[model samples]
Target: MTQQKIRWLVVLMSLALIGLVIFQVVGVRETLNAKEDQFDGSVTEALDAVAHKLEKTEVAVLTSRRLAAERRKEKLQQIAIHDRPAKTEPKGRKASPRKADPATIQRYASHSPIVQQWEFYGRVTVPSDVLNRTNGTLTDAEMHYVEEYYRNESPPLNPDNRLRSELEKTYDETMFRNLRKDVESVKARRDSVGKFLANRVVGDRKAAPVRKHMPKEAAAKPKVTFSRPRVSRIDSARLPHRHMTEFEKAEQKSRVMREVLLDMFTNDRPLNQRVDMAILDSLLKNEMSIRGISIPFEYGLRSDDNPHDFIFTSSPGYREDRLLDGYSMQLFPSDLMATDNMLYVYFPERQSYLAQQVWTTLVSSVILILVMASCFYVAMSTIVRQKKLSDMKNDFINNMTHEFKTPVSTISLATQMLSDEAVAASPSMLNRYLGIIRDENQRLGSQVEKVLQAARFDRGEVRMMRDQVDLHELIETVVHSLSPQVEARNGVMHTNLGAKQSIVTGDEVHLTNLIFNLLDNAIKYSGEVTDVSVSTASSADGVRVTISDKGIGMTKENLRHIFEQFYRVPTGNVHDVKGFGLGLSYVKKIVEEHKGTIRVDSAPGKGSTFEVWLPF
Candidate 1:
């Protein structure tokens, strides 16, 4: 391809590769981000789960304490009952119903308002809006009473007063319990009927007519039936901090009451006992494994108010500095006593773990990208080199055409001159034209042979005439033949035949051509006054031939491709030098056929040296 087309191709291919690389990079980046987000979500969920479990265990512990206390009291009561004596029964007589003792009734009536209300009206009726008037919080006096009741250090300040208050508390609790039961039954009825039969508001009553009403009989007692009452408003202060609404699913009031109960039972308990770090660790591990997170981790329970203050830790590494590095979750989130404790978990290898999720894809993509880059580079280089070779081949063909045309034209012109009768009569002129034709014919044959030899060697069709050749004698023969050209340029050819043995088994004809080509290149390319040297030395390899010239030497770039077919160094404005640019390539091939090697050394403005080594 031409340079322009090659350039466009390279640019287009480069853009494609760059775009693919960018696309891959972006995809990997997004994948990593997704993995990270998923990891964070899984970790947060696990942490919340562990915190929730800790809260459950704390609640269970508080409930167990209350049960143990009640059990102990019941066991003592059972022992007392067992020790007491049983009353004897009268034979064949059913026990009569026991009447209340008048003194016991008098004592209770003196202390309890419930007893007084029953005595006066013969029915205890609590106000409908009584619940709205009382806030759920206990007063200072009530709190002291509760504390004293639980401690039981001594007799209460007023035992009867306490007993009367307890009775009133029990009566209010029973009334509310019965009311809740009645409301539940009414809800079921409403669901079945889809609506209440009686309206929420009480209706006006009509006077009973004498015709429809029945006369009162002896010992007849009438009972009045009341409609369902309207729901009274509750005290806002007694309600949970967050109001319950239609949109709210969880019962905030119930959850708050549970927290309150838990705090009341466990407020005096040890703070560390509220959560077990060991159990918390187990819960975290199980949750994380469910999400495919199998890695070492550290966890800590730190105070929410002051994170530096740790309540407990699975490991010391989970500290204040690393608190931000981990997932944080509130422990016993609704527990009033354990509200300050927060859970924190950190993993040292979290980044590595996330990277490993796409490790196979990442590694494979990078390797493929490198291989593609390498292959692209090699292909581009091969294409460009082939283009250069095509250019060089064209140059060689043009040079050979000119070289052959000059010789053939001269030969044709000389023969034409010999055909002149007058020139033939002049012996000297006739002899000159004949010699000219003969020399031109020899030139044409030599050029044709050089081309044929190079082509045959390239096709591996040139068979070597294997024979022992003496390099010392071969060098001398080539030098003698080119001595006249060296003289014409006022140049000298030096020889150093220092080798004791210079015999090598090789094709005599090809070896002679190899030596002749090297010597001829030295003479032609050397400066006006050619300075050439030919030397052969005895070495471990049998023979070493060196041909060097103090000539217009080549640059490093030219020396690199000097042995490539159809490659020639640029010699500007010096048209006298001419060749098919295949001399060195043929020479190198000939040396290789004989199991030898050739090398050159040259730099700009410096002389050039060509070295040839052959084995015996």
Candidate 2:
């Protein structure tokens, strides 16, 4: 395509690429936003689950404490008992049995017959063996003291009294110790459950392994069967006064147990305490993991009343004010089921996280842009190079046609003169015409030979017949041969063959042609009074030959491409110097074949220097 069209195409392509990039960037941004949103959603879900678990764990702990208290109460009740004081029999004959208290009978008369009968029967069937089986374990005085203490019919037992010791011996102080142990066990269970739930919240499988903690002996224990408590009915007349039926006693115990359970559920003390920092940290890490955020973080709790004070933090290095400097998330107390507190979590590597999420898209886009730019650059370079070569080729063809046409036209003119009868009659004129024809033929042959030689060198078909050659002798011969051309141009040629060791191994014919090409170029491009210099010098590794001319020198731009095939210095409408532009190219190829280096130095308004270094 034409240059204008190519430029337009490039512009259009660049605009299209820019548009595509913009569109893709927008799309990638949106996709990244969506991914970020998904991550945020996942984090929120994980945090919610942790909050729920924490709340549940707190409730469990309160319930365990309440249960422990109830157990202790039951143990205390089991160790103490109340009994009615025994009535004394009369000394006189057949003392009449004591009548039931009048107030007790009146109270029983207020209820239904069945209820009254039950109460009365319980009183009648009351155990009479109080302290009877433990005769050796406790003295009568100790027994009476214990019974009186439970019945509230005497002063309370003193820890220092002998009665207290006797009571402890009979009652087994181990029961109180057992009650303490049960409380401790309950506390341990609560702690273990709390830790387990915390571990679950953090996804720590190693924290509490179920199989590792379970005792093998537990599997060997026999299952115990449980039966419902049985209720008994009694006749009121057969029961003693101020007694409770078995059903009533069991009902009262059940009511106390229910109260304890209700208190357990209603307790809110656990929420007042500060949340466990380790558990909070674990929970944050778990949420981060679920959201695929692998970054270092710190967290702190802020109370609503004192927002500046952090009640708890993972580390002292954690700064609450700088929390918003990075990626931060907040959890309010309302969301966590705790006192008015806020949890703030900060991630230090927020940018890194974002980059990680979009690196693929960014890298791919950059690569694509670079590839496109590179392709465009290469294409433009190739086109420019091809255009330059085309122009040079046209110049070569025109110069070649002119060069050929000159010789052919001269030969034709000579032949036409020889064909004239008048010219044939004149012997000198005929001889002169014959000489002209021969010279033109020789010139034509030399041009054709030069072209053929260049082609052979290009195709690697010019085999060198290596032989010992004298460089000084070769330079002298070429200078002498070209001296006539220099004189014809009104120019002077100087040769300074200064090399002492000028003998080298090379093909003599090619070397001769190489020198001839250089000398010819120097003479051809010189001014009307051209002053050319040819010099030679010996070096440690090679021979150096230099050809210089005081002609219209070439610009630096032209010198750069001077030796390229078909390249010529621009001489604005001046066709005075004529050639196919092949002389320097051929010289360069022959010099290289002989393992030599060639270089040129020139500047506008100043002369040029062509230096050839050939190895010995």
Candidate 3:
């Protein structure tokens, strides 16, 4: 293609490549975004599952606390029952107890507000037989009293009041009062236990301490007043509770409570925390692995009310805002006590995740682009080199045709003159014409031989006839042979055969041709009055020959390709010198066949030097 077309093609290709890269980058970005969105969705779902699990765990813990509180209240009740004084018959009230009418007892049990209130307290124990008796009748006045009490209205001289007074005489008033006190004491213990659990279950040392509340009467009685005893660590399993004194029982109870509270608050907190973290890690890894995301992560719990304050963390160096900077999630506990707390998870290796996601696509795109670029460069270079070679070959053909035509034309003209009757009459004229033909024929044969020599080298058929030869003698003979050409061109030739080791093994014919080609090139490329020099010296393992010319010296660029086949320096439009452009190529080939090397040194506007080294 023409340079303009090639340049346009290159520009177009560059634009296409840039556009493709941009499009691919955009596509990759979108794909990554979509993948990130998918990953975020998965993380959200996994965190939600973890949050749900935590909520369930919280529910279980709370249920356990409620059960523990109930058991404590039951124990306190049993203790109160054990401490109550035994019931004794009243000495002054030996009078027969006024029996309640069957209808009255039924009325009180079924509908009386006072009896309902007593039953609600769970303190008063009434006999089932008394409520079930149906042997007596009620008076109209007693019926009126029962109706008034059930209506919660005041009555005039109510029979229900008189019956209550008689029943109070039969029942020990102090014992009832003590039962009420025991009920209050159980409630207080339940409240204390509730407070203890609330403060300790979550294992927060900064929490408010459990307060003690006692009634005024109980506070006044030192013996009856419940005091929390100091407890030291002990194995509850080894304690003999059955034979213990009251004080020892109290101490054992206190110790058991302390141990249970410590286990729940201290040991259980860390264990549960670890379990929660394990669950979170497993969920996160499973979700991320499914999506092919591998990244380092951290998790922590923080109060929702105070997001900056971390309650707990899976590891050190946990920052509250790390979640905001990278991939993260937040979860809230379902339990009311911990509803303000939030769990946060953070992923640190986000870049690695993105890179891994697109690594294959990126490599494939780069490789494809590089391969295309390399192919384009090679093709362009080959086209340019081939165009240069085609031009050189055309010049070579034209020069060769001219060289052959000149000799043939001269030979034809000489023969024509010799065939003339007038010229044939003189022996001198016939001999002169014959000599011209002979010389022209020899020139033609030499040109043909040079062409054949190049052809033999191309086919790898140029075998050397190895023999011992004197390098100095060879140089002298070749110089003598080219002396006439140098004289014709008015050029000076100098030789310095100063090598101590001049004998070498080589084909004399090819060696002579090698020297002749170099000398001929020097004369051909040189300006008018060409100046040339040939010198020789002994090398480490070879003989060195150097030929220099003070001609129209070549540039560095031309010197590089001077020995290439069919390559010639541009000499303008003037056809002053002629050649097939194979002289230097043949010279280099012959030198290499004999295991030799050639080197050239030249610069623009400066003379060139060709040095040939051949092993002795």
Number of the top candidate by TM-score? 1
Q: Compared with the true structure, what per-residue lDDT tens digits does model 1 show for residues 1-616?
A: 7899999988987887888788888888898999899999988888877777777877676667655665455455544433344333334543232223344434444655434322222221111111222243334565457556756974555863564445445654554444433333332122121222222211221111112222354124343343532223433334224222321222232333344463544355544666676777778889999888999987777665555677777765445657557788876666434556677788989889989997987988798788878888888888899899899988898888888999989998998898899998999999999899888889899999988988898788999889888888888888999999999999999999999998999988889999999999999889777999999888886788899998889987888899999887788756678898989999999988989889898866668999999999
Quote the lDDT for 223 in model 3.
Answer: 38
lDDT of 3: 0.68
Give the better candidate number (2 or 3) by lDDT: 3
Clashes of each: 1, 6, 0
Per-residue lDDT of candidate 3, residues 237-299 (tens digit): 443233423323433444344444333333323223533666666765776666555667777
In what order do the candidates fall by TM-score, top score first? Answer: 1, 2, 3
List candidate 2 segments past 4 Å from native. 20-28, 76-272, 309-315, 318-322, 327-332, 335-340, 425-428
lDDT values for all models? 0.71, 0.66, 0.68
Could you tell me how far off, in angstroms, the CA of residue 85 lies in candidate 1 after the best superposition? 5.7
Better of 1 and 3 by TM-score: 1
Clashes of 1: 1
In candidate 2, position 48 carries an lDDT of: 70
- CA lDDT of 11 in candidate 2? 85
- Runs with alpha carbons beyond 4 Å of true place in candidate 3: 1-34, 68-291, 299-324, 333-348
Report the number of the highest-lDDT candidate.
Answer: 1
TM-score versus the correct structure, for each prediction: 0.71, 0.66, 0.66
